[model samples]
Target: MVMIHIPTHPLVHYPGDILAWIAASLAGWWQHRAFPRETERLAQVTPPGYYVALALGGVVGAWLAGSLNTVPSGLAPSHSIAGALAGAIVGVEGWKWLHGVRGSTGGAFVLPVAVGIMVGRWGCLFAGLADQTYGVPTDLPWGVDLGDGIPRHPVEIYESLSMALFLLAYVPARLRGRAWARDHGFHAFVIVYGAQRFLWEFLKPYPKLIGPFNLFHLICGGLIAYGFVWWRNGGVRADHGAQGSALSVSQPDDEPVRNLP
Candidate 1:
């Protein structure tokens, strides 16, 4: 089997970071266009300080989670998207509770977040060994050499592709006005992301923390659980105030994912 040589260049790596954010912006804009009113409703009910909590939580979570794994592994400090996601949820949820706001407010984030992850992971892939996100050596046909001569699983690419594929399915289903997609898209994103990450962890060379699982495995497990709980708490089966009693949205079968505020 042929192995591909992946360039380990800061130039290659840093550009992906920019492109990822740009892609997220474009996706967010597109989604906003697709559902202007729902977007507006999400905006109106969203506390002005919500963004602040999300940003702070994300930054801290990324750093803290990455460091916890890398420092112990004798690698330089790093940051993780998974950690950032977890942290952002904690921050936003905490803020919402304090403000007495509830329901699935992350609907607006589904596309942007998925597209962002799909593009951002390419940065990690190009960063190579220095980035410390590479997987264990493998004899697989698609193995890549990221500066190292040894062929290994391209875990970063796997994650990026996973998100990309998810978007392909989600967008079409969402646009078709699927009830489940309208109501629980964010939770689905969370659970799928977590599940995929959990599987990929096994391919990584990170030190095992519990049995054969690593730190990320634990974090991913929590994420999966969180997604289900959040979905049940704010989903179609939700008892009341899925929108915190201030506002509630209902989708119309006649309209494609249309939810009037």
Candidate 2:
């Protein structure tokens, strides 16, 4: 990897530093997009201030993950993507629990993972092969050579382009109706992405077996299977018998609070 040093003059920031900032900003935007609207109430809760808080949390979480070498050690695109994904997942979910979101709300549970991976993959592409899961050697025109007597496949671009297409498809599907959302919406994206990422892992240079089994392969297959079944079976099954009165939460307390005229 080549590191270019920038003089600390007024106008110049180091390239590495600049890339980090850009990736962080993109990560923030991507993470924010997944916030679901619960009859539009989520908008009131998740404003610019909420996002600012989340971003700061993400930054800290990512730094900690990096220091701990949470996955693998490298300044590659894959690591960047992974870092952003990990941070966003924790940050978004933690924010929801902290805010005391009772019942189900849109966006809080699943969007962060979906959107974060979708956007963070670009960072992987720009960061180059050092962070890639390159494929087996081939004479096919698109193979990349990352030294060590190896010519690998450009699986990074393949995954990115594929996800972009899928995300486009998901947008229209989400806006159609509640039946679409309840039945097959979230699971569709989850299953597809899981399958894609799992298949793409084969092209990577990392170990196929993390422990007793192939972790990437297992997760991909398992999530896809689970998502498919869940979608076909009506997604999350809420226990109506256990549910409490909604009015109690929505209504004012015994002592009346002052309201604007």
Candidate 3:
């Protein structure tokens, strides 16, 4: 069994997070231009306050759920992608309901968020056991020594690779004007993420809140359920199917969409 050695330090740990955010921002910019007209249309209906609500919800949920799982295990509190997703959903959906907005407004976020997670988990991998994202000890040939003598499952890489594969399939689907991708891409992302995360949690050493289930497993379950319901209600279009490829970013917008909200 070849063990992978990763040196641990604050610099090693935090830079991955910084890079992840930067990458996510770039991806968002690219995706925004990729579906310009759709962006405008969605924005016109989306509340300006939606972002604010999402931020608030994400922060609160990240802390609450992350700490809920980690602190009980006597580990330092941290944030969770799963919790952030849940928070963003509650915040955005609650805001949408208040403003009478309908349908999947999350289309724009699908790629960027997925990409963010892909990049962010690497930080956890290098952050060593302090990041609390490490998996249990494993004797597998590919196990990693994250500054700890015991080789453990490289779960962070597993998550990052999974999201990367998702982007490969998802990005093409939108460009090809696949209706399922356009309508339900975000929902599908949530479900896929939740399902994958749920499976991955089983390998982690986090204290289980339920019999054989950690806090994240429960959180992932909720996310999967939410994704299903939201997709059925919002992403399902009874009106029409794909006319053609959505407005391509390469083509100029008739008018630059500005301050839509």
Candidate 4:
């Protein structure tokens, strides 16, 4: 079995960091132009300390979850996108609650973050078997040979493609002033991504957290539940104006609302 090996450089070793920086930059640009008031509101509502707290919480949470999930299963404990995402969500929510800030601050991040994940998965795919992100064996024509002789499902590619499809569907709907897409964009992404992740978890070889579900499956379930509850409890209404109306920053003196970020 001739395994495929890609030589690593400094950039390759920190793909996550590079992708995160890109995502942050893109999201900030979107917010600055599309939702300046929202940005200003966040600056006021979310303290400087909250950023530090969120960063620390995200790192610690990712490390802890990754460690727990990998070490217990006899795999080398390493960083995982799932763990980082889950940790960031928890950290931000905790900080929001502590600061009494309500509504989703993640609306602007939906597209950028999705793009980042889709790009980052490429790194996982090329990392080969050592990264532990490889999938189970498969006879499918397009199956990848990740250092193993037997062809295997390219699960990372599957996830990246799924996210790409999601962006295709979501971006158009959001651009067209779709009611649900405009008002509940963040929750919409969460629900869709969570459900997709839940389905894809079955293809992974991670140890089960319950009977057949793994830790990531459980995390996906939690995200789905949170997304549902958040939407059900009128979270969308709080952020947007009228249903079907384009989302815009609040302004004085009755100027025309700008949509498209």
Candidate of highest lDDT: 1
Q: What would the TM-scores of all predictions be?
A: 0.89, 0.53, 0.89, 0.81
- Please provide, for model 4 over 128-233, each residue's C-alpha lDDT reduced to its tens digit, 9 standing for 90 to 100: 6777777887767777776557677788788889888988887788668676665567777788888888888888788887999998888889888887876776
- Candidate 1 runs further than 4 Å off: 235-261
Clashes counted in candidate 4 amount to: 1
Clashing pairs in 2: 36-107, 133-204, 134-203, 135-153
Candidate 4 yields a Cα-based lDDT of 0.69
By lDDT, is 2 or 3 better?
A: 3
Candidate 1, overall lDDT? Answer: 0.82
lDDT winner, 1 or 3 = 1
TM-score of candidate 3 against the unseen true structure: 0.89
Q: What ranges in model 4 sit over 4 Å off?
A: 1-13, 16-20, 27-31, 235-261
Query: Stretches of candidate 3 above 4 Å error?
Result: 235-261
* lDDT preference between candidates 2 and 4, better one: 4
Write the residue-wise lDDT of candidate 3 on 53-93 in tens digits: 99999999999999998777677888888999999989988
